[model samples]
Target: MSQKSLEEQIQQLDEQLSSSVEHQEREAKFAVEANERFARNIACFEKYYPQIATAISEYKVREDFCIHVTTTGVGNFVPKNHHAPIYGDDPISQVSAQVEYGIQHPTFSATDYTASPILEDDKRIHIRYMGALTKAFQEIQAEQKERLTVLPEHFPSAMIFGIGLGYHIDLLLEKTSFDYCFLIEPDFEVFFASLFCTDWFSIIEKVDERGGSLFFQLGADEQTFIQDLETLADDIGAFSVVRSFCYQHTPLPEIIELIQQWSSQYFRFQYGHGFFNDAITGLAHTVHLVEKNTPVLTLPKQKRVDLSTPIFIVGNGPSLDEAEEFIRENADKAIIFAAGTAIASLSKKGIDCDFHILVERPYYNYKVFGDFLPPEEYKKTNLIGLNTLYPDTTDRYKWSGVAGKGNEAGTFLLEVVSQTLNNKGIPLMPYCNPVVANTALSFAMFSGFKNIYLFGIDNGNLPTGEHHSKDSIYRNNLDDENEEGLVCMGMNGKYLPANFGGQVESNDLFMGAHFQLEKLIAHYPNRTVYNIGNGAKLKGAHPVRAEELLPLPEANRDINEQVEFLKSDFFEQFNLEEFDDTLLGVKAFNEICDHVLGLAKEPVSSVKEASDNLLRQARYVYAIRNTALHHLHHMIKGALLYYHCPMLSLLYTYTDEQFTLESYAKVNTLWQGYIIEMKEYYQHNYRTKCDHGKD
Candidate 1:
């Protein structure tokens, strides 16, 4: 036993330990744990998933522990040397304890499936569970809706959750139509069994012959599956459908759960994935904001409303029909406000709403005033909206109070003006909801309305398939047409059904607004809020039936009094120096742009160096906002976002692209040209304002 021989002996013992049952068991436990983790991720799949089994088997496990093929009439070896279950004693059982909706892989039991001697007329051999595979075929037949309707031809891509012996997959290919099919089989053993049991080669050839795409994600973790899905989704370019299938008597609950969770997350990502685009769009709107001299008001010096004043916010939901009479009878009892297009509905009914809260800036939205109301109606009601609102709509109101747009772009523009003019811009409201209802709600909160009653704020449609009250533009448009889409959860956690035979639809406009309103109301516990509607539920707001709302005391307030207060507080009085600040600010911004242009032309060796320099230039441009040049800083901020973010993205994404001096020159030239154009436009405005003299 020399030193070399002793080392060899130790190596041999190490090899034996690695091959021991304890090591194998630990590995099996790790696999089970991984599967469990995957199962947990699957529990939150989309609501659109099928509720029935959809898989069938092409191979059978006989009593002899061999895979008996029905498709190819072949027998294959399934390793059974390790008698211990690969997944554990109860693989599918753990899924029940883990998730509300999840799938667990069935245990590999040879005795469970029985082989049949009889063959179909097509010469296909028969496999069975207790002598017949009728139940499996029947399960798939019940899920014809999923294969045919849910995974329709319209969707270019299809994601299959369970590949249980490839039965459901076979039906999906032959029964339905799609450009591509993505098979996600989470269980390695199940997929392996399918390979040995079925004629997968012929299936692939058939799919290829049809000129359709087929991708397989086998035994993948959550991350791997998600990444594959994302790439597939990107390639498919939207409308990628997802469906789940489980084999009869051998369902893959874990995989089904995974698909569910994936679909939910994918939808969430799609919903809120627009930061850079928003900034770009906001920059475009900032130009419109300045051109109109839209009376961009900063916050008033003091709160206008008494915090105790009861306020009623009226929406255009169908529930408003019932509230119309109550609002009319007690018109003066509370500070009545109409949100978004609700103004049209209330005005059509001859109900005098005190304030028309208009937050949306679209030209189409302004039709609520143009198409629905007369000029007299617009004049009578006070208008409160974002400063970024269309000037055509805002100018119609005799008394208007504007708040900052509340987005990053709107805030940037307002903040720059505030810094330059030494006037604190109107209080910024959170535009978290993409809908005008939330805008009205934000303004209500801004005006110090404590006890607020929301009327017709039904975030959904009525039973008659009406989204808005009669006389509304929405109702008028859909009067003769029947279309479906827009689904939101009801108060009872089930889908709110519509009269048109589908779930009540909720677009981004309503959903975003509802969520924002919920958050806003949640902040104030003592301030009582009531939703006087039977539409979509608003959490944290007590529901008050329209009939229950009583009218009593006359309001001590008048519209003119509030109108005068708003004008006196928010109206901007101009001076000559302020005009000079605008001119000088534009000059300073151009100078910074020129400086950055010069930097871009300088030789840079690495992507990091170029990116760092560009970023530094962006920061320097941003810093100029703090100076007297701040009047034009809004444009500077916009320019910085436009240039900086894309540059950073390119830097990270295309690090391998060699930074050429010529490329820098091209980019610098582009920005320089854009800034010059903006400067000339501002110069024209400055000259015109200068000629107008003091106002």
Candidate 2:
């Protein structure tokens, strides 16, 4: 057929779809038939289990959800350990129940990796028919029985596995427990078939809140599954696979090795060196790969013991000067967790650190404290940052102090410190912004500290004229003597000195800061983060102005009036530390540069292996890039949809081929404000001044 004719015919067909009376009648008939068929199916199911008809009728399933054949038995049946296996009560409601559930909230869209063009049309690949799967399941079941021995005698109290349809799960439940299962399937056609399984099945859904998407997604291709496995492995602590999902792609031996490494690392992440640390000798090399270019976390770490211990997270706010005496007096009673920049000031005051965290994100001065210290002190302080942040830090602190992502380290510290001491460090952040306050407070919670007292949290700007603006506290060229003192690094009229932004309101945005602080203070009941001077704004007395917002003495203030705050940083902090239980993680993180710079040296991979590996790693990269794109597809689209972001403007116009994962992460972080803005529309909690392509 001619190209023009082909195009015209397609267009005609599209018109016919919209215009034909016959089509409308057919659609109406189809709808009617579908409703009838569904009614009959429900009737049939009720008939099969008339005794529990009420329970069956009460079974609730979300509307407009597609059911995946894989997740059919999730909620319908209960596992052994669960007590009251209500559908989707929480992820692993009670591990002891025999019933399990699967529920997902998919926000970003995802798809499978591309495969051979020939495979696209293969009837066998579509999985529409189950004869093959039936046979495959039969064989796998026997194998599963053998593998079952490897599993503990007690299966999880309740188990939730994703079933593409009910076939695999239906058969499995027949062999096991059913009264406690709850299924979640994303495909409607598949869901209906499974729901017909008597009173044994309850179906839920995975909805994508970002309008057209779901919070979780399945891999589209073999490559997608591999990538998904890696992501799943990251959180499992120790695991070889995501419980129910299957990967059809046959990975190379090396890729399998990577999987093994992932399993090992996850083991370390959970069981620690007891399982895989010494089994793999290149721990130092792995640590090196992960340490580079990460951000400094403003995370707070405190020991747990006694009923209460005060903590102070010193920020470089001018108020640090006034609070000095109080910190000096109570420094020993509470741990002083210094923000990277304030460590110098705290150190100069002879305040020792029981816990020190560095949220060294590159965008901020991640290495602000790195260069300031002499070589020996490397072992003295604990270095931390967001795992996302550390990808960019230089390899300076290896084997000396622990270098874990703030998110991960924070969770560990919370657990560890909570058991060790009674007193905790008080959070003393300087930024007036709510995000900063929230971040700092979240870190405190994770570090085992409760009952935090707020200090140096001048959420507003520095006093009328005595702010960091006047002198130069934030100069990039800060020396050892300077971390505690100010060194000017300001633009002539950019900040302080009244010329900044040419508006008094700009300088007065501290009110906005206070507004945010107030909101932040409302969230945590266990915390106390109030402005001591009743948020007094200082007049022009610079030095004298510093006294307006220092720490408040507990002996004098009304206990109830102390402001408290809370926020969830779980996704970042917990996810990071969870990886440390495995030495595999350390090996996985090591790079050649890492081994060369610090710690125990390791041999490089063979040149041939490197080349061949890069080829597959390239594939992994493609999967990562595509997955990220899928996750942020809405945001990327919005970047262009709204012309407000210049970076997105440049990014959107770049060649499509150039949009690799490495490039995407960098560019996205570089111009994050626009991206963050787009993400906020999806995740209401996402807020960042510059991350969302604000400019």
Candidate 3:
């Protein structure tokens, strides 16, 4: 009886063994197919995005992370640091349902849809028209909340926060497409695992077929994710990213933090749009300066003078009042350069700057300078500024030099002129922006100054709300009552860590300057920058109180001779006659105008179509690379983004197709008119209307 029972048990055991063997065979087959797909995906990335391809190729897989195949033949990831699977039992159904629900009940409110209106008192034709257009669109947006109930069929941009097994991406693409898709995976291991499970090759192909861009932020952590995204938005068009459908695949802590950072910093892309009139004015001023034989401030060929002579970059902040005695006592010890209206403050304190730097391009800046300081005060001070500085203002200084401002039409023109006359072009100043102190610091860095000292560059306000020094032109213009909260409101209207340990109120402009100063300071690792003021805390700068400031030895070198040597080493004078033929010809200008006009005039049936049209327009302008009209692209790109972003926002926000199309039509008509006006201005008036200075 026992022998028969044993035979039966052996038969059952053999059947079970056979079943196990088959399961192993099936799993091996799955692994082979997954590897094949991963190879194909890597090949696709190599063709399109080599960076991601290289990262995946170089990735070292974690020992504990394994791809677990479920009973239903779906892959799930188990991370080394995690206790459980990234996806539960049924990843397919779970992701499918998530995608379906996400599509039907989408979350679009994550972005700041508020449009930044052009509020500057600019008289340029484009600025005025865009301002009016912005106001009109804002009125339209005011009605969006009541009507925006459904999500649009398509979007210009899509951001995938996490890629667990990458199933949601496939599901998303199956439903709709995006002009630009940014896929962010903070953990390289997760992304690498997804390569085996998901058909990324097909995804890249589908996106490519639809004329879309796919950006991979593989291995990007929370700290750098937002900055990388911002940089991508900048390289592409910021307007194209007006509305993006954010799909969060996994709710990891890192992913959540990245989303929060993005939500907070997205507004940065909306600001700093260069409008048309400013472009024209900058061009005119630059051309006039070049024609007048004004020297262009350039990078030094070699470190001719000892940079140890501590150069002080002075700003007209309230901290200047406290540091006046220290600065005055050490005036001869260090070369002082006054930033913007700081000259007036320094003059009031009977301090003379070696160089007075101004950045604003308008004629009013020149007029204001004259009003603040008499010619006698700055007679010994050298004038250093952007190429767009008013030509008449340069005439009042002892000597003058200019540098090319980044992303300016005037800068491009100067580059062209330089290229035509000489084989080389000027390099734009790095981190020069939003404030005069930035330009001063950039100049100091560019000139190879090793020991740079920042005084009174209070990129914030005192607790009492005094932003500028009492003797500053701002305070002189205002009575005591009007002196409070004197600074212009910035993006982050809050307090920041101050140099001396207390908080100081800051705004967008000051915050931008603070960030730029930190970046510049970090950029020159060889230089030591000391901040001696109650300003916002700079990351890479050493902070010292005025009382603690160690006395620097008086420069052994002849200061005047050093200044002359710098002028000779880093300044160039170009022949104005050489630039006559270098200006963008009428044909090329008209061609660009026509391209924009064509995009504006294109018929759009849906919000998606209109969004694509605007994207195409932005891409077209930005794509005018290495041409004379390339600078024109920079000038127009910002205004285009400023106008197009809000327009697209309205089109997407309004659910009704008819209303959306109607709004698009009205905006398109206005855009057409603007382009026509711009074309006319460039064709008929550009050469003759240098009335700001040349005429």
Candidate 4:
């Protein structure tokens, strides 16, 4: 009522007006920028090169880093171009429809196939399919070879998640060099088929061609994915990415345990029942985007290109002896890329590598590289490996992140290599064997060169038997090698390791190294490839003998205009920083939501639909509200391993831990609410179906 009080109210009103106006202005500006970036992102993938875009979405991106950069959609939650296989039925099937690729729980029944699998081991039909697979594998290599240069200048490797036959797989293997290959084939029938149809030798050679590796993929079903995880727990600490897909029908608690275990095991975990984000996140960050192409990272008036000497790749298959003459004659003319073990032999035989693509991942067998290297030459030679040891391995073992002590070595190896190369190896294409074909072809695409020459990349089952003749390690895993491990050569030696100790093959480098390589090459396809090894078969059963082909001179390939453009403006202009603000906002949003925890909670908007998609991130957020994630993982698993109504358990299953601190009671409350509702609905639905059947 006093004059002073009246003035105070007026002052407060004025402040509110200013703040509101400022906030609105900021919001409007943000909206415009967001739309622009989204448009650019789309254009980068669609107009410039659509396949590159799709491949990057699946092969090059990494979720933890790329999620913050941008979202698929801008105006609303829905995106304009839905990238990938989305399951939608006319009447809306919810999780039922989207779970097409889903693996069933171990105890679950299989869908009735009108035609059951033929148990008769018909040698004739099997041999014919084997012939077809072999031929298809070779031709695929040729096609990928011709298509390598089609990519824009960003990604450096290539990765194909699953095999639908050996078409895409063999294409990458024989064609070029990828940093690493990640292959995941969970089907038993296909696993056996690969044993005969696949020429895994070429995959090993291709991995050797580039400084990369190869690994396997496995998905978690309720029973098996977990059991397998535990079985492979000690060995799985070195994966690049642990990926899975599950639907609502899957036991929710089991899924949580699987994710937690994977994360703690020094692996990057990715999952999607039917979401594009899961795949894209892994591919985007794995890419090594260059300044010559992306406006996002481009600088003004960048020095375009400089013609450099042609580099020759030297592999260690039996085909090595075949290329001896050609390499010896042109020894002084070009750069030689020696595969892992081939280094020692070739270097001794007066065929020294100018740039060694050191792809070996094991501790014992990989040491052979040191024997070959002149220590002075080691510093000068381009020592390429997966992001396992660059800038050195000191940082990974110092208890970084949430990973346990068991995962220290694997994590360090990856961190070291990821930070190793500047941008020279920006675009590398892989020439993997049948085992790692996709990864090899992916690398060939990214290495910035238009022409890739592959030697000793013999994809045929090694002539001396299953093992590569050049390798002394007995390195590759012969059985699971075709299935769960895209994993390249393992550590071989007499010395036992200190931890579990003894001659155990390291599985850590399989997923992490190779997956990164595939993503790189998938985006950069200009540097296409051709296999010159005797066993580097393409187009038919017979290998393409490099001895028969005419060789090209080195001087002609030196002055490529593209390379110059890449080097000049790529560093200063291309600003990864521009996307940092956007990334921060995304991280904040995720922190509040909890990534994996959301899947375990009740959805407000649509329960059935949300359950089908089953978000993992939200569930992670929910879990963070309480006991350590490591401990809660086991607790949650024990409580919900079997099918108990989640809603019922949350309401009264009663964990002894304090529910108040972590909102456990609230979760229980909502979980029980869903169950009671579901019980009533099930009765109604049962009656309705019965009535319909009677009619």
What is the C-alpha local distance difference test score of each model? 0.52, 0.32, 0.77, 0.34
* lDDT of candidate 1 over 1-695, digit per residue (tens): 79999999999998888757554565555445434533332331111121210122223444555333222222223333433322323333332332212123311101111122323332111111111233322332343321121222222345566665554455445544444566777765566555433445556667677655676766666645665565554333222322222123123456666755664444322333222223333443444455555555555667564556677889878888878878888776677778877887787798877778875554545653575677877898777776546555667876665667643444465566666566554456654356667877776675556778888777776545566677565634453456332222332222443322445456544555665677677655566787875766666777778888878465556644654555566554322232223333446655765676666556667654665566556556556544555434444454444344333333332212343323444455555554455545543342221110111
* Global local distance difference test of model 2: 0.32
Candidate 4 lDDT over 549-666, as tens digits, reads 5666656444333333433344222333222222112233333323233444545433223222222322342353233232222212212211112221121211222331133334
The candidate scoring highest on TM-score is: 3
Q: What is the C-alpha lDDT profile of model 2 across 358-443, one tens digit per residue?
A: 44332235344555556555455444333223322334443112223221222233233223332332232322222233345445
Which candidate has the highest lDDT of all? Answer: 3
**Model 1, residue 212: what's the lDDT?**
59
Per-model TM against the reference: 0.48, 0.32, 0.90, 0.34
Which runs of model 1 end up more than 4 angstroms from their true locations? 1-305, 360-368, 408-425, 475-504, 556-695
Provide the lDDT at 558 for model 3.
76
Error of 4 at 497 (Å): 38
- lDDT string, candidate 3, 175-199, tens digits: 8887888888888888888888999
Considering lDDT, which of the candidate structures 1 and 2 is the better prediction for this target?
1
Order the candidates by lDDT, highest first: 3, 1, 4, 2
- Sort by TM-score, best first: 3, 1, 4, 2
